[model samples]
Target chain A: MDYHWDWLFFFRETDDGLKYYDWILSGLGWTTLVSLASLALALALGSALGVMRTTPKRWLVAIGDAYVDVFRNIPLIVQLFMWFFVVPELVPDRLGMWMKQDLPYVVIAVVGLGLYTAARIAEQVKAGINSLSRGQRNAGLALGLTEWQTYRHVRLPMAYRIVLPAMTSEAMNIFKNSAVTYAVGILELYFQYKQIIEKTSQVLEITIVVTLAYFALAFLMNRLLAFIERRTRVPGLIVGGKGSN
Target chain B: MSDFDFSVILENWGFLAQGLRYTVQVTITAMLGGILIGTVLALMRLSSLPPLQWFAAGYVNIFRSVPLVQVILAFYLILPMVLQMITGKQMPIGAANSAYFTFTVFEAAYYSEIMRSGIQSVPRGQVAAGYAMGFTYGQTMRLVVLPQAFRNMLPVLLTQTIILFQDVSLVYAIGATDFFGAADKITQRDLRPVEMYTTVAVVYFVICFTLSRLVKLLQSRIAIIR
Candidate 1:
């Protein structure tokens, strides 16, 4: 067998190849959009669930626990497919048809990815909130702040700062998982890569390019998250010291 | 909806069973393959040589960053092309059927990081002790370090197994008739999405739930041993 290396295939002006590359970029755009939307939703839902899990009320804690358990245990693709296929059918007929036909796929993608990631983020937030001293809560109560006020003004901000690093990893995980949306035909980066490979038969070139794109995005995200984490570092906390306080 | 029929699921139980078997097979194969490959990568990353460490690190970073679906797609589409290019012949059906090969290689990149962390978590003092006792570095790693590291890694391994089991479904995109693929075919034919998907979901839940409990038991046992 003979081996020939063709680096120029990636750079050459080929119609099918260029179109495939364009499709991949479009897919990357959708991936980024879905990931950002899901990140927003996860933050909102996760914070509420996290706060509720720490609530003194029995029913709220139970509700929060059940929500986390259901989402955390299920496979993400199952959840995505369920939402995409089963969910629309369960709705009232008019609404169902609208969702199945007119409603945007991106919305469903965001909901699926967001809700799943929220379960994890909730746990991280709960840990972050719990890591603080009981004295802080008592101090807020002692100062005559209402429960909601205290949390809004003091506890949440602190918890958010503490959980930033964990949240960063969770966000990255969610972004990567969002690629599964391509299965439902969302035309995300991976989906585009598949289309490209099928057309040009330049499987290796497309894979290498797409892989590099993913790495660049993830690396940038990590740096951004690290920056946020550093900015929020509690004064006097040992920055890089290991062995857990 | 009353249209949701239990009878359909009951009638299709045999097909579902077949799918479940295939899913389990893929899961087991992928888990074992991934763990073996991941362990080697982990050791490579931990090696004294810079190039090996760099290569392994790059592998992990690239695979981990890309979505698993992309990795699977790459394996399905690219592996065949590359194979044909090198061998001057079409790849074997057996290699194609065993999509677990791709799943395992992809998963290994992630597993290596998991294993590396577990290995690193072992106290340096243990290695020093092993060295003092005249054990070579390889001997110390094999006899002293890895056992302790594996013990520490039980829970993570279990979690990874659960993820791997779920990932087996992605192979369906490439035409492997795993549990999800079977369910998809059934749903397409029977037009009973609710019944078929619910059955599929429950089957997955039970397997994952059982494995999770097993993980907890193993963790407790490891705790006792430590």
Candidate 2:
């Protein structure tokens, strides 16, 4: 019924000649890499989808809606499995072979996570754009600006600022969701924790450390976003304030 | 591409149905437990006591910061040890049972945030009005404020539940036989990864998509009432 706790197991070396801590550190690196790369993709694709969703064209809006609905409905793990196992087969033979044999798990994870998260971010961006006054769009048109120019200049900047808070949560979510990559055998932080625990049988200590690592990452992201929100606060433009009227 | 086999899914329909049943069961149990615990946490966060506020805040932040899969794995590994320590005997918490407990605790963090916002959306006058009617603090919350808050946040709560339903798949990390886990096992045994995964994806999509549309309709109806 008793257990021996080893707090120093992280300093020990594995059969692969790397210190246990080094493996964990590499896992952290992969997690960060996956999150950053996916975040970049999500933002670009999501912004485009969001704009499409809010457009006057019916077909474009339908396409955007379908994208969001499909991606958002399916769970991340299922999507990851689809990307890893099914997508390679669906492509051309040479490319499929490359994906199965040569493509890195990191790239697959990035594409899967990025596309899924883009659906969520697209919703946020759509809401942000919708929150702006209709007059803002009309005023841009009155200034003899083209529709594209009005969206580029008048709509997107304010919409981005307005959505910063929502985006903050999404960013944190992406980091947490990166752990799903572990299911596909990616050597991320969660995977490393599992590896260390399995090898050393020091489950509690490793769990605490891994939990702290995730907490620190999320806390840092929260603080960073809050700072940005403060810096970007518009004079008379407030978000979610009580009794602003 | 033209030679897709739909017969495999039909053959395994019973197994898949059982798995879906387990998935829905876990989702419902976790949703109920989460909302129950979340309401208490919400009240704790809103309470005037600093310790309560800190405890609630820490609980919410820790759960939100960590991934659910990690949490599930940790619980699956750690629960047995904790149980043994308490009872001075080995007590193995099976994967299915552990999934229920872990999902409830993990989801409470999210539900608490939603409940907190729901509580805040209530007008301050409602509380004063409750007091004006000669009600105590608990009476005020239990009777007036909570009912209205629940109504106001129903759509959001339902939307979060839809997410919780999807998240039940992650219990596969612990080898729990939820819907996704069942599919994974079949794929491994039958070597039909394409069909198994596609069917799983379509099932999840149909269920989630329908629920989301319902939530949207509810949201519009709520908006109109307001």
Candidate 3:
């Protein structure tokens, strides 16, 4: 317990002229950017895949299942490595060169994280759809809606509502999972911990600060999502209803 | 541009196999340890005691909020210092050993949540029935409640283990030579990122996908029994 505790170390300027805390703030900025961008991509693609899995067509179901199996089965760090290092070489020469040399690391990190999370979200979406009673779909059909139209107008809206809380959890998950982007050398918050510790050997301080940053971010995200959940709640729905707990 | 050079994989089979063994070892160890500790935490949370509930809730929330990679790194840095203070001796547990400790505690937080739901899923009437039969609370929990709860949670617990299996690869950040780490080492040496990464990805896919299918099968069987 004889270790010297330097609380003011974060205010000290670094070689880049920015204070260490400022550098950490930029890392937090990258983390937020990657998480939000990737979450947007995951929601769009995952909803489509989820709907595909529920369709009557065998081929669409197979495609959806395959996407989940492939993406969900592999560890994310390995996937990030492949996306960063291996994917570029597999493409056409000009496109490969562009991906390798010109594309920002953030885009690759986002795509990798987005694709991986999309698989998990697709499962959630599928579960939400399945949880709805048969009458919901039957009512849509009886109302003269086509299958696609039924999903759009009737099923998806309700399914999304029922699964809002779970989806919110996934939103929180992506924020934490964004830390894995450090593997691809994105300068996110967790990555900054490494950089700072290496530079100053302030391992304990850096770890504590970075951990607190994540805690604060997650707490705020949870509150914001809970507010959104409450604002959009359906009175008789599973999430906000009396029977849920 | 070049042919897929899986020859590197075959050439390094021995090294790769050892690494895969380590991955499986950590997964099994952490899975068992997590569930053990998690069950205790679950019971603590479900207890009527306020202090016990608060402690369990705080542990689960804090662990769940932070990223696993950060926790892994934090433990990697902090465990040695803590160990030194406790033992009054300098003892640096290496990356691989620390991975064991960190994943167990980290996965416990997640496992506790699943177990909590499992416990709650058991009907209150069942507990009442246990009490009517003159069973004490501990006896009722051991004989009646936990068995049913564990059966209900088996598929979910297994699914979590599959996730734990994949997450063990994160130990690479601290330089542990698990399966992915082994592949990474070979890739760095042979400079064949494509072959090494593809092989590792396929290996992970085959194992995890098959386990997921089995879990689904088990779930259906449990549903049938119920």
Candidate 4:
């Protein structure tokens, strides 16, 4: 075999190493920002929909169900493309032009990632809320709390705690799915790697770096979530056990 | 705009049909290949030896952590170069086929984890009974454990298949002319992105919705068996 290892090329400036490194770092920064923003959006939207899904009002339940079903059924990439390319055109001319020109790519990334992941997150949040004992809600009602106040004071915290694991997985998924932004010309880590490989033809080295970088970042995110889980764990509930892995 | 334009679809029927065939082929190939590799990885993960478990963990982690598109792109670009160096022969097919192979491999990683969970969900008593009845460990796994595990895992396996079907569209990035690529091509050619994509989306919805119902039916049947 005549395969020559070029591991050194990744580190040496003579091979445009600095430029590649900078590109990758910036990509990682955007990826992190997009993931965090989307995580927040998904949590907020998914929670509201999830709560509304359990509402006694028929219309509210219908709306929540429709939101979940429509978004969940569609593929994320298709949705991203539609939002980035098509949605703007449907807006008023001035607003549409401004969105096409001035809207940051990260904003599109957040919307795409947030809405796509929200479907799954909604399911998780609903599961968490449903898993709580019925008596808990009743007790809140008995204490003179309104339906909304009962949920706010009693159900939400417990549901959030119970669903931590699933939420972590969902967040991880959103982070990974952010890679789809590359299709819309966002220079995230995966896109950066693609550009570098195409330019330098150092395919293996660039791929290795990209893969390692993604794995490390994902691992760190998992650990961070795990830490939060540990810190916020209910005292009498399930304690440290084997990871879902 | 015309409420319906049958002629545009009729004109592009050949391309769309070809894309559908490729999409179905990729989904089936990935499903079968993923299940086989996934079964092996699940067994390895469940093995008594620490090294085997660790190796399986590493494999799953690497594939699961990285984005599927990156994997496809890597295999498309790097596989041929490495193959050339080793075999002194060019890979006959270009980047697109390699991307399909990558999708299959990546799907295997996720499928293995799902299978492992299914295997672990099997009651330990079944394996013990198999051993008591003179079955070896492998026989216990194959005859006793796996059958039940598979039944338990049917729903998840079906979900994975649906996801894999959707992921077949990613081959578009590497120029494989699958369903999404065909839609994209039509959009570019006809300058009607909305109509083309809407058609494609409906096609995806029909397939996915039907598969999900099938999954529900399988789950009910499995419940009856239990």
iRMSD of all candidate structures: 1.9, 1.1, 1.2, 1.9
Q: lDDT at A89 for candidate 4? A: 69
Better of 1 and 4 by lDDT: 4
lDDT of 1 by residue, B108-208 (tens): 99788888998999999999999999999899999999888888897998788897888778775676777888888898887888777777777787778
Where does model 2 exceed 4 Å of error? Answer: A239-245, B224-226
Per residue, candidate 4 scores C-alpha lDDT tens digits across A1-245 of 55556766554453554756777788888788888898889888999999999868999989998888777666777777777766676677788788789998778878988988887888888888888889999999999999999789998888888888777777777667888888887878878877777766777778788888887777777888888888788888773245433
- Of 2 and 3, the candidate ranking higher by DockQ: 2
**Number of residue pairs clashing in candidate 3, backbone atoms closer than 3 angstroms, sequence gap of 3 or more or interchain:** 0
Tens digit of per-residue lDDT, candidate 3, span A1-245:
66778889999989899899988999999999999999999999999999999988999999999999999999999999999988898998899899999999999999999999999899989988988888988999999999999899888988887777788788889889999999898999988888888878788888888888998887777788778777777776556233222
Clashing residue pairs in candidate 1 (N, C-alpha, C atoms within 3 angstroms): A27-A189
lDDT of 2 by residue, A26-102 (tens): 99899989998999999999999999999899999999999999999999999999999988878888999999999
- Residue B12, model 4: Cα distance from true site in angstroms: 1.8
Backbone clashes per model, in order?
A: 1, 0, 0, 0
Question: How much does each candidate deviate from the true structure in C-alpha RMSD?
Answer: 2.9, 2.1, 1.7, 2.4
Candidate 2 CAPRI grade? high
For candidate 3, the per-residue lDDT at B65 reads 89
Give each model's whole-structure lDDT: 0.80, 0.91, 0.91, 0.81
lDDT (10s digit) by residue, model 3, range B120-204: 9999999999999999999999999999999999999999999999999999889999999999999889998999898899999
lDDT of 2 by residue, B1-226 (tens): 4555799899988899999999999999999999999999999999999999999999998998889999999999999998998998888889999999999999999999999999999999999999999999999999998888888889988999999999999998889899999999999999888888999999999999999999989898887545
